[model samples]
Target: MSEARADIYARITNEIVAAMEAGAGEWNMPWRHDGSSVARPVNLISRKPYRGINTLALWIAAHAKGYGDGVWATYRQWVERGAKVRRGEKAATVVFWKQIRGRIQETIDEADVFDVDDGRPRFVARGYAVFNRAQVDGYEEPDAPRLPESERVAHAESFFTALGIPVAYGASGAWYRVSEDRIYMPDFGRFAEPTGFYSTLAHECAHATGASHRLDRDFSRRFTKQAVAAEELVAELTAAMILADLGLAAHPRADHAAYLSSWLELLENDRRAIFTAASKAQAAADWMHARQRASAAQKESEAA
Candidate 1:
């Protein structure tokens, strides 16, 4: 990298680290199927031989440039430890490069490497496909206190409108697009009950706030399950932040055990990720807060 480019990389990394420290990102250990214990995948370094360009780009943007010596020292420690595992000098709990390659290879041997006409070799990126072990049994639904029905609907409508998106009620719960204009609710009937309805909407509305139209967040494409889990952490954290700001208590959901493994693996592999994700979460939350303020101001003006 050129000196200028290197500087930019460092700056991005520093920003990411700052974000993580502020509760925008979370780091944890990988979970196992037994639900009673956790273990790092054994092939942490030997499995996957390389990193993806997008992952590297994001990492650089979030960590490299502006960090202080103290931060750099911590990062160095992670790298050194990771390197040792990669070199087969250490026994790591998390599986690395080689294991990743083996998993991919098992799915497709000798993947078509290039377009015959273009003569461009296809590049394989690092990602994971593993069993889910994390449990969501302990999570409790959001507390819906005794808010009026009209108030809940109005809140949901305003939240979605601010982001210029449509809401879709689902069977189980709701999900909003961060990259597109889609609202997903698993089963609306299930949530038809007073408390269920608002709680579900609240979750989706929180997602809408992170949409590109609203927060300009980069939660669109994540190659690995770990990366995806990391993004989820950002989303959930952002939701909690919003709920807190609105004087509402946040609730937990189930079925995150599978993601727990990836989440923990990523954290063990990259400490800087915690910082980067946290920063992005905070940015998303700030963006949503700003929109709420703007919307309220517009409403007041209209009334005037």
Candidate 2:
């Protein structure tokens, strides 16, 4: 990797790691906000949502600056569209992977390297500067009408339901059963707040990412006390990601306190643990969220 690419990776990992460390016991991801979370940031010109680490980086930038919307564009992109970024407004940095010619090295066949119809190219992460529409003066914000409260709840419920998981409501302390491939929760009426229910459910859903057929989280098979703690840490981070995506408040459960010490210990032992856990947690949440749409599309295709 180029030195610049390496720096981008290091900088992103360091910032996210520090944020996660500070929020160890608090159960808050740095990107979360009090109100509706911004949807994934997208290129206003291309109409494409940012993906992977760029998604988290832009979200963190927006949350920090209190950007009210998720639309973003390069300074040139803004100019192209006859919009101007307000003077003194800072740009957010996002990285995209670019494919380039592979480097040549000794002990490898030069012929083999060029054998393909097109020479094999290696992907490197490249960073770019962009401004959110909220930072641009002339750009009018898009109308993002929210669903009604009842419909919003129904949407969240239906999204998960279509994923085809067996969820049972009861007083089982609210957890995903890896052994049985089931989720247990208190009855809807028992929870004092609906957000609390979703919070707990989101955390458990994060754990489901580690199932053997899925992300295959280590603790799913080992089940050691330490592994369990690590897994819980993953779930906590995942819950934060999900809540941020759904625009729900980051309200961790009362039992969140129990994982505080474990998290601190884990972070202390491994400086990069938080970064790893946070990235995987995002992946888990993304998997679940993406499945919601994929399931819907498949059903539509089948009906046709």
Candidate 3:
């Protein structure tokens, strides 16, 4: 890996490490948004949500700098929109990759690489700097209606139903039964809040996404002894991303809090661990989103 490319991974991993350290005992990671407009970090110019590591990086910057919304854009993109980034405002790092035929890993996320038909590796990592809307001027926040709790819950139910994963309730604990290819959860009534039920369900669904026939995300080779920890990190991150997209608060699962130490160790030992986890998590979330889209399309066809 070139020194330049390595810097990108180190920078993002270090920032997240610092944030996690800061929130250590409190269990408040940078990804914990207050169910405000900051759910999914989006670009001001394209109006599209950032994905994977970029989302986490922006969330860390926003949490540290106290930004209230998730909108962000490149300095040039802001200028193009007639908004000037305020003087002396530092930019956050967003990493992207370009496809290239090479054997060099180049500090890219391992999960991003694939063998083309010709058997050459694809992808080279690059970084971009972006400023959040909070650091810009001459722009106005768009008005978006917030869904009520009832509607949010209904939507959450529909989303999981669309995935078609068999979920068994009344279990003593919440977990994805990989052997049975199903998810087992405690009864919904047991959760202190309705949102908690969905949050936990989202985590299990993320785990289920790794089924052999599904995303097929395997961490054993890359993580070695830390494979389980890596998988947990992926599932946790995936659940947080999904809940944020659903416009719901992402509460930390009590069961997962214990894994914090392992996560820290995994990230500290490996510069690419977080990137690999984030990439797999993003794939899982995208899989769920695709299912939702397919189900919606099917329903519309039936109605038509």
Residue pairs that clash (backbone atoms under 3 angstroms), model 3: none
Task: Put down candidate 1 lDDT per residue, 1-304, tens digits, no spaces.
Answer: 2355334334433443334343443232111111111112111123222234423432343233211111111123334433211222211111123222212223333333222334333454333322111111121222423334353545544664675457654212245554557776533333334334444454456556555556655543542546566766665555444443444433322222222333555666776665666566566656665777788898899999
Q: Higher-lDDT candidate among 1 and 2?
A: 2
Residues 1-304, model 2: lDDT tens digits: 2355334334433443455455544333221122223457778878778888888988898768756456788999988888888899888888666555756443231223323335667555556889876666555434533223452376567756765667876332466778999887655544445666676777777777788898777853433445666777678766655654565643333334344444567667666666666567666766886788789899899999
The parts of candidate 1 lying over 4 Å away from their true place are 1-164, 170-173, 177-180, 186-189, 192-203, 206-210, 219-225, 250-262
Per-candidate TM-scores read: 0.41, 0.48, 0.52
Report lDDT (CA) for all predictions. Answer: 0.41, 0.62, 0.71
User: What number of clashing residue pairs does each candidate have, in the order they appear?
Assistant: 46, 0, 0
Candidates ranked by lDDT, best first?
3, 2, 1
Backbone clash total for model 1 is 46
TM-score winner between candidates 2 and 3: 3
* Residue 95, model 2, lDDT: 68
User: How far off is residue 55 in model 1, in Å?
Assistant: 37
Ranking by TM-score: 3, 2, 1
lDDT string, candidate 3, 1-304, tens digits: 2354334334433444455665545332222222333477887777778888888888899878756557788899988888888899999999877777645533554335443456565656678889976677776444533324453378888999999999986443467889999997655654546666777898889999999999888888988899988998888777766766677743434334443544788878997878888778777878998999899999999999
